[model samples]
Target: MADKLKVALAIALVVAGVVGFYLLSEQALVLRVLSVLAGVAAAAAVASQSESGRRFVGFARESVTETKKVVWPSRKETVQTTGMVFAFVVVMAIFLWLTDKSLEWVMYDLILGWK
Candidate 1:
């Protein structure tokens, strides 16, 4: 029952937000204001739920903790890897272009007997 209520409320919030946005589309000022207002209301409603709210909080905390544990590459390593990737991409692009032009030339000049 609680889960159903939460789901229904979430759906209703989304529908309301969509409707509000559609209605406000004609008025730029109203659209901007209502957009922020609807977003805040939606957030507040989600946070108000007991079980769902606790889950959200836990999820956020776990995400932050996992992010902190990540081993980010050094600036020098990142730059070197980026350069290598770019070099490979450019080389592959040039190779493909040449192959395509050669195939086109063969088909039109030799096979089709076009000058």
Candidate 2:
């Protein structure tokens, strides 16, 4: 029951923020932005009180930590790999083109006797 209330309150907070932003359009731009941000933060806080929300926050934190630990490839390594891939593709394309032309010549000039 309490979780449901928290979820409802969070939704209400976010909706109210959107509505307030439009309502305060005539006000200073900074004030309108701050008001909306405050409402969003409040909604997030309310949401964090729920079990699922807490779990989501924990998962996000863990994901960020794991991402930070990842070792990305250096620029030089990336360039070298890309160059190798392009070289292989060009070689394969030439080989296939030669094979196609050879087959065409054999089929038309040698076997068919048609110009």
Candidate 2 differs from the real structure by a C-alpha RMSD in angstroms, to one decimal, of 3.9
lDDT score at residue 78, model 2, on the 0-100 scale: 97
Q: How close is candidate 2 to the true structure, as a TM-score?
A: 0.70
lDDT of 1 by residue, 1-115 (tens): 7866775776677677767777777778777577757865895576557577778878999999999999999999999999999999999999999999999999999999887
Best by lDDT: 2
Candidate 1: lDDT over CA atoms? 0.81
Cα lDDT listed for each candidate: 0.81, 0.94
Runs in model 2 deviating more than 4 A are: 84-115
lDDT of 2 by residue, 87-109 (tens): 99999999999999999999998
Q: Give every collision pair in model 1.
A: none
